[model samples]
Target: MKTSPYGAIAFRPDARRLTVSAPSGELTVWDTSDPSRPRPAGRLRTGRGIVAAAWNPSATDLLATVSNDGSGALWRLRDDSAPEGVARWAALPDRPRHVGWVAGGSWVFSMTGTGRTSVWDVGSGACVGRADLTGGRPVVGAHYRGSEVVAVTDSGWARLWRPGRRPSEWVRLTDRPVSACTWSSTMLVVGDLDGQAACFDAEFRPVHTLRVARERPRALACADDGRLVASAGDNQAVAVGRDGSVQWETYLRPPGAQSITIAGDLVALSAGRPRPTLLALATGAELAGGRS
Candidate 1:
C-alpha cells in the first residue's frame, strides 16, 4: 500500500518535538533532540483527516487541529500515556483549513477555506466570536497572535481582523498570489506565487523583499532573530538573513518541500515523503537519517 503524504507539520520549540499529520488522521510526534536520528515519541488519531494544526503558545502539551470533516479538536499529550482528546466541535458548514491558539492558549480559533473564522474559549468549548470575509478569493495563509488575526488571500491582499470589530481594509502585499506565510513577534513574512518573499513589520509596513526561490514558495518559517527559511517548487530550500542576503541553499529530491518549521538550530522540512528531513539551520545541511 502507498503511504499518504503529510498534510501538516508543526514544531514545538520548547521540547524539540516535531508533529506530522497524515491525511489518514494520524498525528506522529517525533523526538528531535537528537536531530541526527529522530525517533517517534508518540501518536494520536483524530479519526478525521486533518488539514492543519497548531501548537498552543502557552501550554506546551496542548495542540489544536482542524479536519476535512468540518470539525476541530484539541488534544493533550501525556508523558506516561498516549495523547488524548480534550475537546472537539463539529458539524460546521465550511471546511476548516487552519487552526491556531491565542490569548495565551485560553482561546482557539479556526479559519475555514471560505474566510470564515470562529474563536472558541478553551475552557467551555464555546465559540466566543465569529468573523467573515465576503470576497471571492480563498484565504491562502493566516497567522494569529494575541487577539489579532491576519489572513492573506489569493487576490494578493492581507487583512487584519479582531473579535467584535470590522476587518481592516485590504493591504496589498504583492501582485502575485500569496502561497504561504509565517510570522514572529517582530515581523510577518509572506511568500507569493512569483517566488518572492516579502517582510513586513508588526504594523504591516513593508520592511524588505527577497527572491527566495525560482518557483512559488510552498512553505515558510521565520526565527525570532529574523532568519527566514523557505521551500519552494524549485526543489530547493533557502535560508535568508536579516540583512536580506541568502544565507545558504540545499537541493532536495523531486516534488520539493510541502511544509517547514524552525526548531532552534535546525529546520524540520517535510516534502511529500513519509518522514520530515532535518537540516542545520545555519548551513542548510541535511542531518543523518534525513536522506531521501
Candidate 2:
C-alpha cells in the first residue's frame, strides 16, 4: 500500500479525480477512475499550510487554494504555458479560514476567524465586497444555500448573504455550536455539539432531526443529488435517508474517523487506522473488502 500525510481530501465534481492536501503546503492529484486503485497523477506546490481548497464547478481545470499566510490564489491546473505561477491571488486583511465558489465559479467567497466573509472576482483577484459577520461572535462555519452564502456563528445563529449584497434573513438552529454542515440546492444540514443532525428546507424551516449517539459529529457530508446524508464522529459513521430514517451505521475501529466525503455511490472515510476506507452509500457495506 502507498501512503502520504494528507490533511484534507475532495473528489472532483465529475467523480473522475481526487485531490488531497498535504500539511507541507502541496496538493496531490489522483486518478480515481478506478477507485480501488488511486494512482498519483501530479502535484502543485502552494508554499504554506493549505487550509482549504475548492474546485471550480463550470471550469474543472481551475482550483482555488487558501494558505495559512492569509493569502488566496487561483490556479489553472492544466495550464502548460505557466506551470509555476498562479493565475490570480488576493491578499486580505485577515487569514481566510474558509472558501467556496459561487455564481457558477465566476466568484469566490472566503471567511475569516473574526467573522468576516469576503467575495472576490476569480479572474481579476479583486475584493468585490465584504460581509461583517463579527457582530460580537466568531463564525464557526459557513456554507452556500443556493446562490446565498450563510455564515453560522458559534452562538448558534445562521445568516444569509450574497456577493456585493447585504446579508439578511437571520435564523437560529440550536443553542449549541455547530460543528459541521453541508448543503443541497433545496436544503441545509447541520451537525451540532449535541450529537444531533438537523435538516432545514429552502426557507430555513426545521424539517428533520437525527441523533445517533452522545458523541459530537465532527464531519458531515451530503450527496449532490440530495438523496443521502452522512455524518462521522469519534468512533462511528451513520448514513441517513431523505425521510430522516437511518439507512446504515458503521462503527470505526480505534482512533476512529477523522473526515468523510460522499460522491456518487461511495462514502469515503479518512480514519485514524492508517488507510482510508470506502463504504457503500446505501447500506454502509465496507467496500474493497474493507480497504482503500
Candidate 3:
C-alpha cells in the first residue's frame, strides 16, 4: 500500500497484517499472508495530517491516531468496508504525541510531547486520570500491560504509574532526549539520536549499549528469538547480536533507512521519501514493489 515518507507504522502482534499512517493522511493496511509479496487490503483517508499511529494491543481492530493539528482520533475498522471514525478528540494543550488503549480497551491514554498525559474512559470519553510531566519534558513513549503502565520521558528517564499512588519520581538515566523506546521479553530498549541504544534489565540499569549507525533514528527492535538487536538510521543500517557484535550492515547508500523491525532473522527496513521504499531486512536487499 502507499505510504508517506517514512510515516510511522505498526505491525500487528499477530503478524497477519501491518498498518501504516502516512503523512498524506492516508491509513493503509497490508496483508502479510504472502510475506514476500505483501499487498494492500484496505485504505482510509483522514482530514488531517498524522504524526503517529498505533494499534491497541488488547483490541486489534481498534486503532488510534494523533493528528499533528492537535487532535486525536479513534477508529474501529474491519475488512471489506470503510473504517468507522468514532468521534474526534481534540488536544486542547495542542501537543498529543502518542496514543494507546488501556483498561481492557475501556480507557485511552494520550501523551503529548510537552509533558501532559491523560487517560480517558472509552465509554464516557471523560478523563479518569492525568499525569502532568512538568519541566518542559515530553513523554518519550508509553506502553501498558494489564493494569501496569511504563512511560519514558524526554530527559532519559522512565516512570511507572497507574490509577492511585503518587506518580513515581523520574528514574533518570542520561541527559540525552529519547527518540524511540520499546520493551521485549524482560528487557527494555532505549535509543537516542546520539547513536546509542542501551538495554536495561527490567530495573532500567545499563546492561549494554548496542551499537549501530552513528546518531541514528530510534529504529531498534529486539528479535523475538532473543538473538539480535537490529537498528537503522543515520543513513545506514546494522544488526548486532545480543552479546554485542555486528551481524549485518548496509555498505551502500543507507536506503535512507528510517525504521527497523525483526521477525526472526528476516529484517524489514523502510527507506525513501514521498512514498517510502521498504528493503529486505537482511543483506540490505531492495524490493521493487511500487507504493500503492
State TM-scores per candidate: 0.91, 0.85, 0.80
lDDT of 2 by residue, 1-292 (tens): 0012454566667665556666566766666666666666677666365666677778887777666676777776662333244554554566666677877888877777656777788777777787776564666666665567778776667888886677886688877777777776567777788878788887888888877336777678888777778888777888877777788888876556656777777776764332456677778877632233
Q: Can you write out model 1's per-residue Cα lDDT over 91-134, one digit (the tens) per residue? A: 25577777777777888888876688888889988777788853
For residue 85, give model 3's deviation from the true position in Å: 2.8
Candidate 3 global TM-score: 0.80
Residue-level lDDT of model 3, residues 112-144, one tens digit each, is 665566776767877677776544566666766
Residue 200's lDDT within candidate 1 is 86
Error (Å) of candidate 3 at residue 239 is 1.7
List of clashing residue pairs for candidate 2: none
- Report, for every candidate in turn, its global Cα lDDT versus the true structure: 0.75, 0.68, 0.63
- RMSD each, Å: 3.0, 4.0, 3.8
| Ordering by lDDT | 1, 2, 3
Task: Say which prediction, candidate 2 or candidate 3, comes out ahead on TM-score.
Answer: 2
Off by more than 4 A, model 1: 1-4, 288-292
How many pairs of residues collide in each model? 0, 0, 1
